[model samples]
Target chain A: MSVAEKLIALDPLALRADFPILAERIHSKPLAYLDNAATAQKPQAVIDAVTEYYTHMNANVHRGVHQLSERATAAYEGAREKLARFVNAASPREVVFTRGTTEAINLVAQSFVRPKLKPGDEVLVSTMEHHSNIVPWQLVCEQTGAKLVAAPINERGELLLDEFEKLINERTRFIGIVHVSNALGTVNPVRKIIDMAHARGIAVLVDGAQAVPHARVDVQVLDADFYALSGHKMYAPTGIGALIAKAEHLEAMPPWQGGGEMIRMVRFDRSIWNDIPHKFEAGTPNIAGAAGLGAAIDYLEAVGMDRIAAYEAELLDWATRRLEQVAGLRIVGTARDKAGVISFMLDGVHPHDIGTIVDTHGVAIRTGHHCAMPVMEFFNVPATARASIAFYNTREDIERLAAALEDCRRMLA
Target chain B: MDLKDLYQDLIVDHNRRPRNFRRMPDANRVAEGFNPLCGDKLTLYLKLDGGTISDVSFEGSGCAISVASASLLTERLKGATVEEAEALFADMIPLLTGKLPENAPREHFRKLAALEGVKEYPSRVKCASLSWHTLEAALKNAGQPVTTE
Candidate 1:
C-alpha cells in the first residue's frame, strides 16, 4: 500500500495509546497536541527505559567498578552507539551529549569557531534561523570581534541560495544555519550549502533540531562539519541532546568545560582532557536521559523513519489544503519543500485568540514568534499560530483543528 | 466563559475606535513592552500629576486583545491614583488570565472586567496583560521612560 493509504487506514487513536500523555485533557478538554515542533510527547517505551535505568542501574558512569556502575556505564555508552547509528555518525566518539541544541551550538561557537574567527572574519547565518542559532553566532562575533552576516530568505521562506553563495568568500569563516526552520518548517538545502561552503574552505554547522525528528538525516551524507539535535524534539526527555562532529573537528575544539568526566588528568598546574566526546562532556552525564533518548530512537526505528516521514508529509499536504479553505486564513511559510509545520494568521483575529478558541474543542497548537523573530519580521507579522504534526497525527485531527478554528472565527466575529 | 462576556460591546467599540489611542505630546512616562514569545508589542504613554495618573495615551502594534486591553486600561485609570491603579492592575490578573484567584479583588476590577474573554485563550493572556505590564513599569519609572521585555 502507498504511504498515504497506510496512514489513512491507520487508526491514530490506537497510535495515541502509545503516548499515555495524549489521553490527558488540557483545560478539561482532550489534549489535541499539534505542537510537535516545540517538543514531541514521549512514548511509553521511552518513559519505561528512563524509569528502568533509574530504578535498576542508577550510578555515575565510567568511574566505578561496581555492578550498577558498570551497567550504568554500559547503558550510557550504549546510548552513544545508538545515537551514532541514528544520525549515521562515523563513530560513537564523535557524538557528544550536551543539555540540548542551544548548548551544543554554544559549545561549537565557544570552542570551535570563536578561536578560529578573526576580527574581520564573517559568519553567515540565515534569516530563518532560530534564536538559538542566531544568538550564539552573535555572541561569538561579539567576543571575537568578527562580523555576523545574515543570508536572507525569499518570500516563500526559502533561503536565497544564490545570495547564500554570495555571502561565502575568503572572509567567510563559517556558515551556521538551521537544517529546517523551526518557525516556517522550511527544509533547507543543506547538502548544497555544505558543498558551497566546503569549496570555499568554510566550516558548516547544521542545526538539525527540527529536521532530525521528521526526516531521515544522515549527517555523513550531508558531510556537515557540525550537526546538532535535541532529543526532546525526537520523543525523548528534555535536557539531553547531541552534537555530531568529524573526529578531527572534535579533537581540534578546545575543551568547552572543565570537570570530572571530561578530564583525563587534573592538577593545579595543568590538566589533560579526555578524548573526543568525553573531552566535551564535562559533568556526570544525564545517563537516564541518554537511555530515554536511545529508547526514543528505538521507537522511531521500529516505526521506520521513512514511513513516519511519508505519513507526516501526507498529513502536511492534507492540512495545507484544509487550512487554505478557511476564509481569512493565510499560511505564513509556503516553501515548495517543507515539513508538517503550518504557521498561519487569520485576518482580523489574533493568533493567541485563535489558539484559545481552538483549545476549547481540545485542539492544541503553538501560537507565538516560535523563537524565530527574524522570520516573523520577514512575514511582517507579530506572531502566528503554528500546528506541527508527527506520524501519529491523523486526518481527523486536522479536521478537528480546522473545525475549531472556524468555530473560533464565528465566536470572535 | 463566552467571548461575549469579555469582548463586550463597549470593549469591542473601544477596540474598534479606541479613545486616547494616540501619542501624548507631553507625557511623563513612555514605555514599550514586547512579549517576544507570542509577538505582542505595545507602547504606552502616561501623564502623571503628583501621584495620580492625570492623562494617558498609547500607540503601538499588537493583537486585538492587547489593543483592546490597553484601551480598557486607559479608560479605567483616567482618574485613578497610582496606588488605586496599581491595585486595579493587580486585581486584573485572575480575570484576564481566566484563573480563579484566592482572595481576588474582583469587585475592584469593574471596568477592566471586560477582558474576561482573554481567559479562554491561555496563550493570549500575555497579549491582554502586555499593556498592564507596560503600565506597571511606566508607573515605577513615572518620572523617567521605561521598557520591558
Candidate 2:
C-alpha cells in the first residue's frame, strides 16, 4: 500500500482512538458501528468542546453586556463563521443556524418558497429525498395551490438527469434535492442540476445532510442557492445545523419565526426585522452544539477532507466486495457514483430480522426504509439492511458485518 | 441476547410458511396494521359468526417475529368468541412487555411463548404485537387504520 493510504484509515488505531465510542462493547463483543448515514459518533474533540462551552462560558447570546454573555455570543457567532468556511460560503452572513436539516429545509420552504409559489406553480424534488426534505415542501405546496413534482431514478438508483431536465418548466418555482441519498448513497451530480436550474432562473436547495460528512462541499464552486446540513450527521452534537444560502436569498427572505432575538425592534402593529442571519434565528439557540460543531470542523480539517474521502472510498469498496460474496445477499443500490453507504437484502430474511441478528454479534447497522419510503417502494421491497462506513472504520468491522449476516442467513434463511 | 431466544425455531417455521395467509374477501371485520419504523404492514381479516371468531386470517409482509406472531394468533384464535380473543390478546401483552406475573400459569402460553424473547429486544416489541393491536382495532371497529409509529 502507498504511504498516504497507510497513513489514513489503514492506520486504524490512530484515527479510531479519537472516537471514545469505538472502544465500546455490546453483548460481550466489540461494537462495529456501521450506521454513519444515520448519525456519526463524536470524537473526543467535539465532546470536549461542548463541555468547555458549558463549563466555562454558559450564558444567553446577543443579550447582556456581561463577560459570560460576550464570550458565549463570540463562540456562537464564531461557529457560524466556521460553518461558512467549511462550506466555502462567500460570507458568514449567508449561514443561518437552526435546529438541524429538517428545520433548515422548513425555514426555506416557509420563508422562501411559500411566498413565491402560486396556483399551478410547481416545486421539484427527487424521488429519493428524506421525509424531512419532501414533507416540508409538500406542506408549503399544500398551503398554496402549488404542486410538488418528483424526478424519478433508474434501477441503478441514479437520478435520470435527462428526465430531471425535462421536468423543469416556467412554472417550477423552486427545486429541493438531496446531494447524497441517505438510503442509496447515490451522490447526485449536484453541479449539473444546479446549472440546469440556474439556466431557467429557478433556485435549488441542496440537502447536504449526507454529503458534508463524507465529501468536501464548496458553495461557491457549486453555486448552490441554499444548502441544508445537519451537525449530528458529521460527528457534531445534535440539535444544531446551518443553512447556507446566497446573500441575495437571505436578504430577500422574510423572517419565518418572530421572537426575542429575530427583530431590530417590535411595535404594537408591526415588528422590524434584524440583519441577514440573525433575522432567521429567533430563539435561544443551541450555542454549545454549534461550538462542538466548530470543533468537529477543526477535527475534519486537521485530517483533511480529501484524505477522509479517499480512505472511506477504499473502505466502502472493501465492504461492498465482502458483502457481495455472501450467498443470497443482494445489494439494492448500485449507482455508478456513490458515497460510503450500502443497502442490501438477504433472501428469505427481513431487514428487521437481520438488524436484530446482527445486534447479537455487536455489529450495529441500520435496517429500514431509511426515511426514504419512495425509494423503498421503487425498489419493490419493504426495507433493506444498510451498513454505512466512515473513515474510522477498519476492515475488521466490515468482516464482522459480513459474518453477522451469514449467521442471520443460517438462522432464518 | 442470544439470537435463538428471539428467532426460535417455531418463529422461523411459521414465518416461512404462515398458516391462513390469505385475504378473507367476504369477512365481516378487517383492519390494516402498519409499523412505520421498519415498514412492516399487515392486513387482518375476520369471519365472525355472532361474536364468535369463526375464522381468522392475515395477509401482509413483515419480519419473522411479526409474521410468526400473526400466524400463531390466527392458529389459536379460530373458533374463539370475541371476548375470548380479547382476553387472549390481553394475556399476550404482558409476555411482550415483560410484565407477566412470575407465578402466572405457564400452560397459558404454549405456542405464544416463542414471542416472550421480544422483551429482550425492546425496539422489536412492536413487531411481535402489530397484529394484536390491529385485531383490537378491528374488534372495536376503529375506522382509522392502526399504526405503530
Candidate 3:
C-alpha cells in the first residue's frame, strides 16, 4: 500500500495509546479531547524527553564549558537542527527560538517590518488572522504611522484571492497571512500568497501556528520571508516555538531584544550582536521545552507528516459530514481546503452553553472567539464551539461530539 | 459540576427571553461590561430617581449565564434603592466567587440565588457576575468600561 493508504489504515485506537492522557476519565466518562487547535496532548515520547532533560542534562546552554552545559547545548542545538529539517528550512541558523508563535510574530514585527515601514505604508493581512498575527502589526503600524489593511474573506471563509491581489500595491510593504485559520480552519493558499507578494517586492510572514500541527510546512518551497509556529500546538511543551526566516532578512533586521547571549561584545559605547539565530534569542531559553520539541519532531517524523496530514484530512471530512447532519447547526468555514478544525454553532444555543453541556459527556472543545475575533465578526457570531481533531482522534470521538451537541440542543431548546 | 445545576430552568428561560433586554432611551447611568475571555459584552442602562433605581435595562450578547445573570439583575434592581443595590452587590460578589459565609442568611439574595451554582464552575463565575460588576460601575457613575478579567 502507498504511504497515504498505510496511514489511513492505521488503527487510531492503537495510536491513542501513545498519549497517556487519552486514557483519562472525566466525570466518569472516557475523555474525548477534540481541542487540538488550542494545544495538543503530548505523547509519551515527548514527555520522557522533557523529563530526561531535567533529570540529566539540566544545565544552561551556549555559555558553560562544563560537561552538563556541553550536553545541554548539544541537545538544544540538535533540536534547532531537527526543527530546521522538519520545516525544511535552508539552515538551522534560520530557525530562531521564541517563546511561541506570538512572540515570534512580535519579533518579526518589531525587527523586520517596523524599521522598513514609512508613514501611510500598508501591512496587508487577512480577515481570518489570529490576534497574534493582527495585534503585533497594529502595534508596529501605530508606532511607524503605517496602516494595517485587512483583505476580506468570502462568506465561505475562503480568502478572496482577487480582492487580496487588489489590496497589494506600491504602498503595501508586508503581508501577514495565517496558514490555517485558528477559528475557521481555512487552509489558506499561502504559497500562492507568497508568490504574489514576492512579485511585488513585498515580504510575507506566514503564521504557521495552526498549520504546522496539521501538515508539513516547507519554508523554502513556499519561499516565505518568515514563518512562525508554536511547539505546544504540535504535541510539544509550551513556551517554545521558532521563527524560520530567510538568511538575508535575519541579517538585515536588527535584533528585537538586547540581553545576554544575544550580544557578542558589549561596551559602554557600542555592542556587537551575535549571529542570525542567537542574536534573536536574548535570554536563557526554554531548554527543556526544546528537548521536548525535538522529541515531538522525532515522534512526528516516525509517524510521518504525510501520514498525519492524510489521516487528519480523513478526520476533518468525517467531522464535517457528521456535524452537517445536525439540525440548526451551521459549520462556519466551508473552505475547499481545511485542516482538522470544525467551528460550529447550534441555533439558539450559546457556544458557552454548548461547551458546558458537551463537557458533561467528557467532550472537550474550545468555545470562544478563538483569538480570531475578526473572523467571528465576519461570521456575525459572538463565539463558536470548535472541535479540532488530531491524528489520535477517531470517528467515535466525532460521534461523542455530535451526541453531546444534540444534548446541548435538547437542553437549551 | 453538574450541568443541571448550572443550566437551571430559570436561567434558560431568562436567557431565552431576557427581561428588560432593550435600550433605555432615557438612561441616567450607563456602563459597558466586557468579558474578553469569551467575548461577552453588555451595555447596562439605568435611570436613578432620588437614590433609587427607577428604571433599568441592559442590551448585549453573552453566554447563557451572562445573559441570565444580567436579566436577573435587572429584575431585582428595579425599585431598589442605591444603598440596597450596593448592599446586594456586596453580598452577590462573595456568593458568586464561592466566598459566601456559611452562616450568611440566604433570604437577602432571594431569586438571585439561582446563580449560586455558578460557584461550582470557577471559570463561569465571571460569566455570572459580569452584569453585577457592570451595575457597580453604573452606580459609581464610572465612565469607563468594566472588564471581568
Q: Which candidate number would show the highest lDDT if scored against the true structure?
A: 3
Model 1 residue runs over 4 Å out of place are: A1-13, B1-13, B26-29, B46-55, B79-108, B116-125, B136-149
Task: State residue B44's C-alpha deviation in candidate 3, in Å.
Answer: 2.5
Q: What residue runs in model 2 are displaced by over 4 Å at the alpha carbon?
A: A1-10
Report the lDDT tens digits of candidate 1 across residue range A274-377: 98899998888999999999999988887778878887898899999999999889999999999979999987777877876787678889888899888888
Worst 10 residues of 2 chain A by lDDT: A1-10
Question: What is the Å distance of residue A360 in model 3 from its true position?
Answer: 1.7
Against the hidden true structure, what lDDT does model 3 obtain? 0.93
In order of DockQ, best first, we have: 2, 3, 1
lDDT of 3 by residue, A287-388 (tens): 999999999999888788888898889989988999999888999999999998899999989898898888889999999999999998999988999999
lDDT of 2 by residue, B9-56 (tens): 999999999999999989999999999999899999999999799999
Each model's lDDT: 0.86, 0.93, 0.93
User: Residue A294 CA error for candidate 2 (Å)?
Assistant: 0.6
Lowest summed lDDT over 10 consecutive residues: which window, candidate 3 chain A? A1-10
Q: Give a tens-digit lDDT track for model 2, residues A1-413.
A: 43244465458567777899999999999999999999999999999999999999999999999999999999999999998999999999999999999999999999999999899999999999999999999999999999999999999999999999999999999999999999999999999999999999999999999999998999999999999999999999999999999999999989999898999999999989999899999989999999999999988887788888888888888889999998999999999899989999999899999998898899999999999999999999999999998888989999999899899888988
TM-score of each: 0.92, 0.97, 0.97
Count of steric clashes across candidates, in order? 0, 0, 0
